[model samples]
Target: MAAARDRGVRLGRPPAALPEGAPRAAELRAAGNSLAQIAAALNAEQVATPSGRGQWTKSSVQYVLTRYDQERADDG
Candidate 1:
């Protein structure tokens, strides 16, 4: 873990809601959608992970959205 961190790699399962829903997640979050709402929206839209699973939990959405926010922060 320390070695990965030293290499700027985030250790853990990569977020499922990223790259695709990431932009939409930020938009929804900015528009005041709760984590549950965001998850529901993604599920309702039939979005799936790269593995083709459509299951989306609130925590998964939160993880993606939080990572998006952090990356945006780092960008500026």
Candidate 2:
């Protein structure tokens, strides 16, 4: 069990929200930061995942962007 834990097995929080800060992320995009760039920044900041991962899985980033678009559409 100890060995398994040492093997990068996470046994804590589910993981952090997938590259959150939707508004912040969108702002970065509008300011010319690419999606990859935003992800990198979030990772660099050590954003936690619900599963306790330290990075995003791409799809997560896309999810945030999609949500933001939907929100804007609804607001207008």
Candidate 3:
């Protein structure tokens, strides 16, 4: 959902799930790769938080993986 304000637009929810590095984490995890490896990949890719500041963390990786895992589990 979106709303128009005097300043412009505002989002009701986050634009997307996780962050840019999220897909890398999921891809590596699905390939049986390590979290550290995923972190390195994200760092190399310059993925950051929603604020566009700071690097991706291990917890973020875990968060994405867990969300994806749970979603798939729920889908079946």
- Residues 1-76 of candidate 2 have per-residue lDDT tens digits of 6887999887777633434467766776788877788777767766653346657546655677777777789789
Q: In candidate 2, what residue range of length 10 has the lowest lDDT sum?
A: 14-23
Q: Write the per-residue lDDT of candidate 3 for residues 1-76, one digit (tens) a residue.
A: 2336555766466435655555667888878878777777877877775446777677767777777777668879
lDDT against true structure, model 3: 0.69
TM-score of each candidate structure, all chains considered together: 0.69, 0.57, 0.58
Better structure of 2 and 3 per lDDT: 3
Off by over 4 Å in 2: 1-20, 47-54
lDDT at position 48, candidate 2: 52
User: Quick one: ranking by lDDT, best first?
Assistant: 1, 3, 2
After superposition, which runs of candidate 3 have C-alpha atoms over 4 Å from their true positions?
1-16
Best by lDDT: 1
Backbone clash pairs for candidate 2 read 14-50, 14-51, 15-49, 15-50, 15-51, 15-52, 16-48, 16-49, 16-50
TM-score of 2: 0.57
Q: Give the per-residue lDDT of model 1 (tens digit) for 1-76.
A: 8988999998888655445777887788889999899889888887763346757779878877778888889889
The lDDT per prediction is 0.78, 0.67, 0.69
Residue 39 in model 3: shift from native, Å? 0.9
